[model samples]
Target: MTTGQRIAAKRRELDLSQEGLGEALGVSRQSIYKWESDSSLPDVDKLVALSRLFHVSVGWLLGVEEDQEEHISNDLSPAQLKLVEEILSRYQQSSQLTAEQQERVSELVEQKVRESRSPRHRRLRYGAACLALLLVLLAGRSLFARLKELDRQYTDLANSVGNITYSVNSQIGSITSRVEEILKSQNSLVADYATNIQSADLASNTVTFSVRVVPKTYTEGLEILLHADTGDGLVDVPAVPGPGQEFSGQITCPLTDSITLSAVLVDQGTRQTQLLGNYSSLYGSSLPAVGISLLESALLNIPRGEDGLFHVRENYGFLTGLSASVSAVNEDIGQSQVKQVQLGLFRNRALLFWLEPCSRPDNHHGFEKAEQWFHLPSVELDLQEGDELVFAALVTDQYGRQIVTPSLPASRVEGDEITWFSTSFDFPSEPDGWGLAG
Candidate 1:
């Protein structure tokens, strides 16, 4: 029966009017009307509450089973009563089980009789004892099922909590690493600007650069040395005291010569090598060269696929060509400009795009721009693992210096590509702010 019909039937059986039932259940008369009219389901908690007040099992109240008026008291037969009395006597002295629990005990006894009886006699004598056995089996099965479901629920809860904690911790670690990097870069810049030049020029007469290695954690008594490449071979710059003691030095070189400097961080605590970095230049020299550069240090390395197998999803959108250049503005101060960069290609919803014009002509800071749009035609990209796409943005400083993020580390383009798979498609028009002419 529908929920509405069941509610109405139950009310009639109890001889209660809609208003009386509503008042008893702490609901308005209209709520009673709504329940009887099938407008909505009663809340689960409210249903449980009503079952208690009416002294009826929730299953029977919900019309899952019939309410037997003839068996209102549910008295047992002579034999059944005798067994029940025995079960109760035994239970009360040890176990405090209710009438329901006794029903389970009756089934257990009936099942034992069935198991020991002959096949011919089993069919005929399948009486009260057999009934009791059925009840016990049902009770045991129901309890088992409920326990299993509870176990599953608890496992799900634990996994969900673990995932949340892991995500939170990962975010915190990323933020801490980024902040530490910024602070170290700022400190180096400050030292370069403030420290007095100890000597004019030393060693190599090649392209001049500086390598700064900042420890994730502070350590005492660490020394840094610079490595340079002469035409014959590479040589190490003289050892210098680190910034831990507030020490700094200067080195100058020729324009054509190439050199690299590695920072070997020594831990005074354990007297062991703490960290070893590839030779990197903070100035003039480019990165990913014969030696590593500062930009490499800034990049967060995402491990690539080992087997070179990657699932590539279909491109259900458009690929717009790079059209215009816009200046990246500093969000802090509107007038204070930062970098000039170029816009990379874009797809519908800006799926994949590149940002160029990273550094200034002076090479001080990177660029930032807000709310720029680029328009392009719909195109499908069938990319594989290890395939890279270059993105360029415009970074124009006060001096009109244009810089771009190097092409070495670009977007790794790949997804699951299945041909003959049908997908819905629509074309997009150029919006007002984004266009080929703009």
Candidate 2:
């Protein structure tokens, strides 16, 4: 059906007054009258909105049959095309305009035609010209009406589209914020879990320490220490990484004793420290898999005294005489005292047989070296009740030859607070002295 017929039919089906339809479409009642009378058309974009409102196609609105092409004529804008379709569909099922409105549109067309006569042309020419002018006026009126309708449709559609876009953007933003929040929470959870694990493990087990001494160069050596049972016992292991080299050894308990695994790397001149396979397992197991782990790894700096030499007597007092006598003339004279005395390393084995005298005052010939005894001035002692007493003595004879001797059984009386005297004597003494009387 034609767009006008469709509008008339839809108006009848809806039983709507011309005024009612005009109000819904946001147009003047006169405009609706003109549309149903076939004097004008709606604009293109309005046509599209009308099609959505009434559910149909522009071709059907334009009165094209099913066999005809569905494309609208070029004269129609997108809105007009849609309006045409809505009018058609509504006309077929629900006429929404009044009979009086249609009749009024017809009267207006006729009145306009009558006024068009003029003296400027022949009757035929004037009629034709008048007809053309009337058609032009009608077309212009239709165009204006369609433009108005489309303006209203455009505003409403734009508002709907903007609402949809805003909703989509809000949803997306919310999702992103939630994801970020979850990630942050997860990170905090992981950190908390790690801390808990560490605290739990420490509380559950006993801590033992192992040390690896590594020397960066030939001058550097590795020292490993273990802190076991709350620092009650110490083990000094015997593995060092020399300078410019690397070495590894297994950490055996009681570090003072020997271990099974050992490795040494030779360097040109400088010592170096390196990792080895055996020590790798021992150190690695210190983590979760193994109960034992190293608290600190470093190159140990051994103090000079810890080497177990250099002793001073527990009692520091002025000496009356430091002496020992040997019964055998040709036997080791100073061996007992030299062996008992503690010094730097060991008794100078080179002086294994030389006789030397210690510093002293009372001279029976200005302090002679006995094949037996050499004395030192008594040194004073600020010893506590259970303190240890120690000293080194040398014995020499007139010949100034080296000799060894056995130590006497040291004695202590009650309330004396002097005991635990250990002494050793060696057969040969270096120029200075041999052992420590530790």
Candidate 3:
């Protein structure tokens, strides 16, 4: 059934009149009618609100499944229930998951289940803990030692949380349906992929790049090659999602003066090399369209992909081609202005990053723009994990200085994935501004 028909059906199921649902949504009765009659479609926010009001999954609302009724099991344990809710919520927000992504998410859920099934581990650990306590009691160790151990454990837990956040940040990409085409450079054929820098650890002397490749045809023994500008030797790693699958991998190469990166296809049965493409990082961002030296950061959304990573779906979008050299602007002092920002997702090293001119609002103060959610120009992205949002501004306090205003994180309402970075503020008490853009 269409979303409209399902809306009408669910409304009847809830015994709510058109006016009643409208009142709940804070919209007029006409809006509800228009939605039901298929004259118009509700945006992502409305879809989220409708799901909560009706107590239905976003998948059902989006017609991902034929049956709309929810059959939640009551016998689930607390952790299991929470895990199921999270997975289901992710599904509701993102229906554009690929088969590989679906499988990865399923594996995560299964991993949780497996962890839960290991009751003996907890019991054995408890027994070991009791034995250790008894030993400590007999060994005449000071209580101070135990306290210090506990403090060390606490610190470890805090570090673990940090690691989790970093892991989550590193593995986000969104999938968007787009016009299926290929980018043919001189030596390679490019399909769809996402390029974001991974956090480097001081312990490892290697730099890793996140490569997500979705190939339409089959190829064997795929290998990625990395070359430094210093004319060093080649670093080759095997490609992931090899065949009949989506490619997503954290490709690690020797950290030399590593500047140029490329990929090649090798036949599994026979060794032959076909060049993918070579990509170079744009260390400095040049925004000719906005006329501001764009500051880039990877602190965007961790939009989950079908493969349980964060990625965007299309190749050619706003991120392609610099349109103008002059950054155009219409300024005003009467009130603050929220400039239009252009964003891009590159596959390899991209240098140019820019944000529109805007004021940074107080984090502990209030919301930025009146409308918290803005639809990304790329509609094909089914937000499974996250898309790290990069906002550039025309502020020229100092050219090339990084200005990353702390904005709210992305969230899901009903069926739509809503992000919360705004360029305006409503706080009147604190009459102050940060960043050199304004």
**Per-residue lDDT for 1-438 in model 1, tens only?**
544555655564464555567788998755665565443446655565565566654455444446522112122234533543454344333433457766666555555444434343332123333433444464555444433443354344333433333333223223423543454455432222121112211122234344444444444655544444433365555445564554334444332212333343445644322222122111111110110012211112333234443333211111111213311111111121333334544332232544332222333233222123323223345445434433233333343322222211224433432121111122121121123222
Candidate 3 Cα errors over 4 Å, as ranges: 71-438
- Tens digits of lDDT, candidate 3, 1-438: 566667765674464555668899998765675565443566656766786687764556665655445322123346544644454345424544456645654654455444535653222123224433543444345443643453354344333433343233222211111111223322244455454445332223344667656544445544443222313456566666654456666665543322454545444644434333333211111111121111121223334445543443321111111233222211110111233333322111121232222333343243221222122222233333222332322211122222222121212212233343322221111112222233
Candidate number achieving the greatest lDDT relative to the actual structure: 3
Better of 2 and 3 by TM-score: 3
Q: What are the Cα lDDT values of the candidates?
A: 0.37, 0.31, 0.39
Where is model 3 poorest over a 10-residue stretch in terms of lDDT? Answer: 328-337
| Cα lDDT over the full model 1 | 0.37
Candidate 2 ranges beyond 4 A from true positions: 65-438
Q: How close is candidate 2 to the true structure, as a TM-score?
A: 0.16
Q: Candidate 3 at 67: error in angstroms?
A: 3.4
Each prediction's TM-score against the native?
A: 0.25, 0.16, 0.21
Q: Count the backbone clashes (under 3 Å) in each candidate.
A: 31, 114, 41
- Candidate 2: Cα lDDT at 193: 9
Give the CA lDDT, 0 to 100, for residue 367 in model 2: 20
